[model samples]
Target: MNVSSPLNNEFAISRRRKAAMIVQMMISDGGNLSLSQLPESLQELLTDELGAIRLVDRDTVLGVAEEFIAELGSLGLSAPGSRDGAIAALSDHLSPTVAARLREQMESVRFGDHWHIVIDLPNSRIVDIMNAESVEICAVALSKLPTSKAAAVLAQTPGERARRITYAMSLTADISPDAVHRIGQSLAKEYGRPVSSAFDKAPAQRLGAILNSAVTQTREEVLGGLGEDDPEFANDLRKAIFTFKDIPARVKPTDIPNCIRTVDPAQLSSAIASALAADEPVISAAEFILSNVSQRMAGQIREEAEELGTIKKADAEAAMSSVTSAIRDLVESGTITLRDPEADTDE
Candidate 1:
């Protein structure tokens, strides 16, 4: 992505305009770019230049030119780094009034501890602020938000709550299409069954509608978890579930199995673990889960006995005995990790 040659496409035009605005504002600030505020690559390049501490105006200008070149390349702009030509072009494009307004905004701007913007604006405004790279102030201000306000922010967030806020909403949902598919893979691992991709079974129009309606935050969280565990299945699932909000609360039990059939048992277990782990002791709630199994499945319960070593052996045996059928079903389905000392030793 050469920054010097601005891609003439719509995306490029918009990005170039934004980039020019940022560059103009930065130069106006006595070229004093805070170390934390610079892009990662630019920071590294500047660090190298600052190391020699070269002070000559010509030398300094050359260094700045180098950075400009780097930025142009990275930004994929057609503008050259040579001061006389590209800089003049940039000057013409950025009006003094626009630059002054931006500078004024920058002056009043206060970055919090995280160095993000400190404003509570609308979501669209938040998105704009993110583009301005002024989100750090917001992160600092976020801690002051009341619990209810914080919750509302979180609900509106699309990815990791803290990250989204910190990154000024620039941080997209860590959840990707690949991650969603992986969740199904994980479920299959635990269940030893073929997990289904919802996209595969449903009509494209219906699936698209479901995804469009899904909760963004939920979809991202689920996709992230799935991606980390099951990349392939996550990709598959990405096609099946367009949005997390697609699933409704009033799902029929019969429909539940169809969804379950698409999920891998290990994935299910992981989801269960995650759900229980979040301020809830899932292990303590194991009994409720166990009650749903049958006698044949109960025989497989002994495999998990060893994994329960964290608990007393006697207690594990007692718990397994108490919910033998359910535990066995979990074991057979691969929902629980069976402690195999041999496997542990090899690892």
Candidate 2:
């Protein structure tokens, strides 16, 4: 009538048992380890091992730590653990076609079960699968997908399919890995879209981002030329480009406080002074920012900027660009929302 403890076991100390001990120790010590980055199978084993053992002797904890440290010291090199990672690291050395082929071959490797790939498919495609495939397969698919996306797909699915799929999910606890793997492979073959990770973003967005960093004169020249040759692309690129002048149009007034907080006081002053320095300056941008911030802060910044007097246009522009970059970061982080440009705005 004794419950076995993985950590307390003095004999047959497996690597997994030791790992669970270390992971538990780290968690107890408030370490924010990204255990999610580990392969799902490994995570499951770690979770199981951790669950089996309630407490560890200090000696076992110290032994595990010492062993882990020694093992780390002994490693001269570590290769990329997954084929995708390996392919990316070796891409410069490998032919593009070869690298792509290797990426496709990833299905037979760590993703051999193919559930990861299946779950990454578009939500609409998943809904279509639910419509066409058996209720059991749809249930298995939902179980494989991340909870939020699964919920969305289930909500979008027809009433009958959704009800059946939910019932099937309850019965999925005992499904065999081999059967799940087979289902995943079949689903992927039938429905998985070939995604090219060649570029993390669209071409227009990449080009626009490059222009964001370019000197204003150079950016304007390029945009002017592009406008003539490829009006459609140029129009799209213009939407992506958010410059100092675009602030008044694109950024929300309410976000100004949070946005400017990211900039240094001197940098903000310089940008303001320089913008106002021009013969026909960007008054709207300066006013937009000043109006949004507190009156005291606005007066202080204006006074400092005026005192600096005649900052080099280039220096001022650089500071302004820094402010714009901070704003972009806030937008990207979902901390602030930008007002839509003319293209998106209601008349």
Q: Supply the TM-score for candidate 2.
A: 0.46
Q: What TM-score does each of the candidates earn?
A: 0.16, 0.46
Kindly report which residue stretches of model 2 are placed more than 4 angstroms away from their true locations once superposed: 1-192, 279-281, 343-347
Residue 339's lDDT within candidate 1 is 35
Best by TM-score: 2
Q: Model 1 has how many clashing residue pairs?
A: 47
Q: Write the per-residue lDDT of candidate 1 for residues 128-164, one digit (tens) a residue.
A: 3334333443453344346575556555555654565
Off by over 4 Å in 1: 1-248, 279-347
